[model samples]
Target: MEPAPGLALVVVSPRVAPGLMSRSAWQVVEAASVRLCADADEPLAVAVTDADLPIQVYAAGSPALLARHLVERAADDNVVWLGSADGDEGLSDAIADEVSRLNDPPPVEVVVGSWDVPGARLLDVVAVMDRLRSPGGCPWDAEQTHESLLPYLEEEAGEYAEAVRSGDRAHMAEELGDVLLQVAFHARVAEDHPGQPFDIDDVAGGLVDKLVRRHPHVFADVEVSTPEEVAANWQKIKEEEKARRPGAH
Candidate 1:
């Protein structure tokens, strides 16, 4: 089966096989269902019996270590011990009898689903700017000049820095997206100038070309010992290009 996206504690048997079960021997269970015991918490010890398989417990956080632990546990035991997959039948039967005797209760009310989300669409910031610049469009967006908007770049960069400092990955992701939008906004305004490739694609393509040229170790036959060597070679090539230009002395 395809691996599940989130965290899981999978049980395995010896010889790296799924433990004996009617279905998949190694079934996936919610981590909350599996509990860890500390020796400090309980002085008395509990031992598993022949009815149980050798238990191999592991969390998604460390798959390599988990797998190794399973292998090591399986080496000493006959069967892989997963959790208590088969609960006590005698206790279950007694519970079922008592449940059958009890009267049914009324169903509780539950309001389903959400209503807040409207929708979303993709549009180039240039198109957004052009619309804003139109005679009938937003006055606030249209009235702003490049000089008035200069601080937005720094503001967005600062937000990005704050997000990084928080160490909350999800917040950082959202903040970085805002920084990217600011970059695209600047690029859109710069595109109005003639003889300048000021679009985001132009910026990206230039970086890609420069990266490929500089990484001789990765993209070309030229060998480079250190990053310093790569930087020196890049400067030499750049100087040669400048010297070849028509206005160079």
Candidate 2:
């Protein structure tokens, strides 16, 4: 007798663009006899339908009912469940409970479609800053200006320094996050500058350029073995950068 078809639950990261899934995820999604999702308007679901694949969107219901439906459907044909970005809360446990009752349950697998890359959470910080400054967002955040935020910036920096002095790693991390919030807030305020508009990306890009330019030992052909030599190289790069400035003599 032929074995029962399996079910593949595909989970994707909201940080990643829709339809950009892993090879294994695409394979299971393409091979599945039935594709299911809770919402038709979800990013992944829209992407799947845009690719001309037939996917059925079930109305919002209880997790147990969804789990039962998935298991029953998987008995005869392969099934693919496109998980939501916020995660299909409680659905996995429900499925586990449903399968446990079956004497001969079909195999079930969770396929990771996409994952967040390093520093991906920084995007979330930027997004939050944007929302806070936008209309209908926080009134205080919207009203903040770079000049007005200077006191906050100084306070956060002082707190971070105190955290470092106390040798408290957790406090240092929290204080560092506060410092980062000040940076994001200033960048958001900068966006409204009429003549010199700049965002967080511009701030990051400049920092990236400066770091690459100074780190010749890592990025370029320059060779430096000792920390002293690296420091010397950094100072030399800084001097060169200063000399290249518009008003530098």
Candidate 3:
């Protein structure tokens, strides 16, 4: 008899909530007679139990071993492969290449169980900036002031603009990081202001408040149908904000 008709490869992100996984993936996992993970101690196993499925741990090795095992186990019963954040793409690739060369290949399906939230790693950037400015931190970072960082800020901004103009995605990503570094650096330096100390949260909070206020179409019931209307509305909101400022004339 031929092997099972289909196999499931469920990929999950470490940071993502297990409940957020797709219903189809859950169905496959729930029906799985054999569930396997790369490691038993991995949090993915914990998430599997949380999802109300029994997952068994396996020794980590080449994808060929896993593929062969899945093919064999799936021959007798439904098998589910629960993968990690990066989703063992290497093993998956190797499995695909190996199975393609064979005369008989069991159908394999891949699904992402969960996805990482966008911009989640940015918190690391903020934390690193704060640590660099903290007590007993980097001496150079500790002593730098707004005046000292101004030149670098200007330079980074120029480079970022040039990258944007050139439309080179690689250069844009690099230059954008440089610009963000300047922002984080400035926010960190402001923490030492004798009269007024402010951190990245303060900076981000103000920006958030400003953005929410300006994008009334998004956050409020204000209806805007066109990009031009949105831009005009943002300008109007900015003027109102400026008028309400303490020193505004």
> Highest TM-score among the candidates is held by which one?
2
Query: Could you give the candidate ranking by TM-score, starting with the highest?
Result: 2, 3, 1
- The numbered model that scores best in lDDT is 2
Query: What TM-score, computed on C-alpha atoms, does each candidate reach?
Result: 0.39, 0.93, 0.68
Q: List the residue pairs that clash in candidate 2.
A: none
lDDT of 3 at 18: 58
What does candidate 1's lDDT look like per residue over 1-25, in tens digits?
3332222222222122122322332
> In model 3, what lDDT does residue 81 have?
83
The runs of at least 3 residues in candidate 1 whose Cα sits more than 4 Å from the true structure, single-residue gaps closed, are 1-137, 194-197, 225-249
lDDT of 3 by residue, 25-68 (tens): 77777777788888765666777788677888876677777777
The sequence of per-residue lDDT tens digits that candidate 2 reaches over residues 159-217 is 99999999999999999999999999999899999999998989999999999999999
Candidates' lDDT values, in order?
0.45, 0.92, 0.81
Clashes of each: 7, 0, 0
For candidate 1, the 10 contiguous residues with the lowest summed lDDT are 105-114
lDDT for 182 (candidate 2): 96
User: Candidate 3, overall lDDT?
Assistant: 0.81
